[model samples]
Target: MLFVNSDKIKSKPLPSLSENTFLRYFSFAALYVAQGIPEGLLWYAIPAWLAMNGKSPAEIGSYVAVVGIPWSLKIINAPIMDRFTYLSMGRRRPWVLFGQLGLILSFLSMSLIADPLNNMSALMILGFIVSFFEVSQDIAVDGMAIDILPVDQQARANGLMWGSKTLGISASVAAGSWIMSHYGYFYAIVSFSLVISVIILVPLLLRERPGEKLLPWTNGEASKAAEKIQLHSWKGIFKSLYKVFFLPVSFIMGVAAFSYSFGRGLIDTVLPVFTVQELGWADTDYSQIFATANLISGILGMIIGGFLIDYFGKVRMISIYMSLLILLACAMSFLKSFWQNDIFVTGFIICFYILLTFTNIAIFASAMQLCWKRISITQFTLYMAISNLGLAAGAALLGPLKDLFNWEYVILCYIVFAVVMLVAIRFINFEKHQKRVEDLEIKHPDINIG
Candidate 1:
């Protein structure tokens, strides 16, 4: 239902790749790899570890929702990142560095805390702080990536971030889980902290190009306005916050994200339980299988997804992939009998894993393409935040549904979601999107299209 007119604005041709270009790409990718470490830890380690700790679905759902709230509520920070700059360190670099430090501290704090479930209230609060800083780092990194990269290489930049991040995620999920299962949580925490500390140090060697035009705060004495703040201004702060709350692209991205996240959240929350309760799989076995899926299959999917986005363009590929995901979800929903049968379960799981790999690739690629290069990261995070919200929503609803219905019936609920998602994907036409971009260039002369 939403149409973006920015695509109509034309910019100069993006530069061709040279030796310098390759160096920049590689360096940025390496930097991304480090940032990716914590992200992977959060995604893979946190969720699975919680499930293993005997957290109920509703409790698990609430925790995820709490963590993701920063992303949804603080999307305003993205635009601020767009408008603001740090004078001394660099535009994005300072924020990235600070965020990285926060990540290490958060992980250490979580690791030191003895019992996640027992100290649920305090742990949840700390988890929220971690998610906030993690998301904040994402905003800066994504905005910087978008601003610095050439238009043609947008997908490549996206690929680097996604591929690297996913690799980190798979490692943490697979390897981290294994280590946690075998060794104590203390050992696992210490080992992870050490690895990430090394990764976070990468930014010391690199830098981002600041915006061409310096703003008032960067050069002018306009910053002294901060000294003028008074208690009465809080009302005005709320009003400004209200106006900044809605961004068009973010709103659309949020809608798509909510749909995607809700569907995904339901599957994630229930799957481990299903594996244990229904399939009778052991932790070690599930860990092995999960790791294998992520290590080999996830890497391949991410690499292929990058190339495919560049070849076919982001919107087209993403729409196709999203549609495919809906199909996959529906198929899984109705295929419950396969899970019950010994002969079919193994093969069905294989198919399901493959489907998940492909679905994630497409979703990521489409999301990258959907957002213009510079804002792609911010938009991506917002989308992710909204999706996480949907996931929480699904988790909250699924518990009651599970209590009232059977496993087969609970999964069948995905059918309704899949159908709805497919319809949403249908509304997105890539060719038209590309044309709209072209038209926007022709019409709008002032806005910087990139």
Candidate 2:
């Protein structure tokens, strides 16, 4: 129902970047991979490394809580992105490039820190800075996805983007664990810097669209017609945020987003500690099972889940997946007694990971559906920020819960969160809200209402 007015803006030949689906998806995947590596290093590899180095579970939890603050606070950066742009070089590219540079510097700084064990304070500060850059890059990459991908392609794009990130995290965990095990912490940090250097090249080389200005050397001029187009005001940004947060359907979607990953966060924090300290699993063993094998299943889930959401509808897919998650959580909690049976434990964990990934893909694709293109980055970031906050809250609780009740109650808590997630999905009438958005966009074609 929504239409683009070809005459309003200058027409140019379609660039290979946009015309080729493979190129577009590849670029998206590469950027996402760049984002994921450090995330995996900090969240998974670092904690395990710290635990192995004799840091208490509580200490590691505090560190993770501090590092995760940037991601949960991304709502603050989203509006800044929406309010400003270097349009001549593509709206989102400048921010993306800036974030990537900051990440490189942050990683390099971490590698320079002399005594990681004795310098926990310095390490935590550096980790927070690294996460800040990573979160910024995420905001820009998401904005780029909204700017380029068509509505029909968004579901698949979300899957590939997230799947690629999973792969990156898997690789980071596998490689980081191995490197730190055989080599040392310094070398491991250096390896992360080297890998990120390679991945950052993807966004550096590619333009946002055909004929967009390149930084530094290019004249940085927009087409005459493009120059005449008025940018949306701050009032418009506030309006879009209001619509997403205040509308009944979108409000429910936000609540569902907040609930969807709460259990995963608690489990993610506790499981590594339990596997390493309690179960006597080595770092490599944990990485191989949870990061590598489980994530491979997650990649399959993402691919399958993407198609299913597009075909069956987002609400239906989410409902089914969340219900499955509850059952899986209950079963896993029951299986905790049989932790000695490595085969059973591994299999159940894999199933849970797959379902988690599947549900996440579906939920994010639904969030994308709710964003209006005029302020896509800000709106979508707000939804994801809420979700990240829930995850952080769950993670922050892991240590205290473990101290009080041990692993069994932790798993029980996950089951309760999963039930709440399912209940939240019931109130989201995405179809009705989407119809309203589409009708608004069709009426005012110049303004992106959805």
Candidate 3:
């Protein structure tokens, strides 16, 4: 059977990812892997390659900071995605497809760069453009996951998603570095785009709910489940988003998210330049080390991180992990002599990644617990946006900080930024926020925010 509207058509529905627990995990993981490939290429390989080629830390740091602009603007994109969509085709699927297509187009555009090193301005612009689409896909997927996954499953699913992303980052960084070194950046991006192209099929084939449209052109209608929560107007969306976002606990989480990443961003920005320039490691050597760290940690994530978060408690786990990281930062800062030892350096990076992964799983899961479903897109994206803004500021600060102080002093500052997260975490009362949302949902039962 076929059905057509005045202007739109949707195919007969397929099974929703929500219908199968396995599908839920697999689909999200697959899409995350897609996210990681390009991310690794842009965030890791390209930057490292530039460093290896003699680019200054200031140049590289500023470039990365600028390219991250789109992610920081997820606050803007969230409302639009939440409010506007062909509901029949699934809420987030449309944006996911759109984002992936834009990513591919922007990726291919890289080939047009005759000389990437010489055209740093163009590189930043195009990278910004790519990040725009990347954030779109990211928010849509996050909202969808919140809507569909059961609470008990969220921690575990997050583990799979992050693990998948790490695997993709490892592969692309390792492979992209090799490709860019032997061939060119053009080949590296083009090859990564092809993998992204393959991943597009995952969302395209998996519907959010049964009886919803599979595609715009096929005969289908919005699932009853979807229509129940779909906000009818922009005003309703914003009103609902504001109602929940201003709650005290939600605001604290945002603060914590921001402060936590600033330290991470500082460390991230310092790594390549520090390793390659100061420590005498080759660019390839650094990338391989990074890839190896991600590979081991990704497996650890898939095997244990999620389960631990679920079993031990999300916030509690995060607190413990934060303490470990602060100690590691102190150790690394004081042991400047160890900086030259390849084994010690590699171990430090890997241990940091491992601890960070455990806490990140918890942190993300905690954030998801606070979302008012009706405004999940905006609220969750805001937390992520705040976190990224911190990361961007940290990255941008690195060059100036390096010029002003010794490496030990620079490393010590991370503890300050990270300690803010510990304090913020101490104040967040998830039950308080959840209870408030519960009360509000009862008061406005018609909105289906629950």
The 10-residue segment of model 2 with minimum total lDDT is 222-231
**What is the TM-score (0 to 1) of candidate 3?**
0.83
Cα lDDT tens digits, model 2, 1-450, are: 389787887845335355577778888888888888899899989899999899988889988988988977788898888778877777777889988888888999988889887788888999999999999999988987876776667777788888888888888887998898899888998988888888777777667666667665764464332233224577657765675567677787777777666777888887778778878888668767876556776588557767887888777887898788777767766776788777877776677788778788878777787776667788888888788878888899887888789677777888777777788887777677778766655665544222
Better of 1 and 3 by TM-score: 3
Better of 2 and 3 by lDDT: 3
Taking the tens digit of each residue's C-alpha lDDT, what string does model 3 give over 1-450?
466575665544446787899889999998899888878887888999999899999999988998887866788999888888898988778888898888888888865788989999999999888888887888888898888888788899899989998888888988999999999888888888888888888888888888777878887788877777778777778778778888899888888999999888999888888888888899879877876777888889888999998897878888999999999999999999888788888998999988888888888888898898777888898788788888888999899998899888998889998899998898888788889998877787766442
lDDT score, residue 86, model 1? 53
10 residues in a row with least lDDT, candidate 1: 222-231
Each model's TM-score?
Answer: 0.66, 0.80, 0.83
The backbone clash count of each candidate, in order, is: 9, 1, 5
lDDT of each: 0.59, 0.78, 0.85
In model 1, where do residues sit more than 4 Å from their true spots?
A: 1-32, 39-80, 87-90, 104-132, 170-191, 210-254, 278-288, 319-337, 370-379, 400-406, 429-450
**Ranking of predictions according to TM-score:** 3, 2, 1
The most accurate candidate by TM-score is 3
Clashes of 3: 5
**Model 3 residue pairs with clashes:** 9-216, 10-218, 10-219, 11-218, 11-219
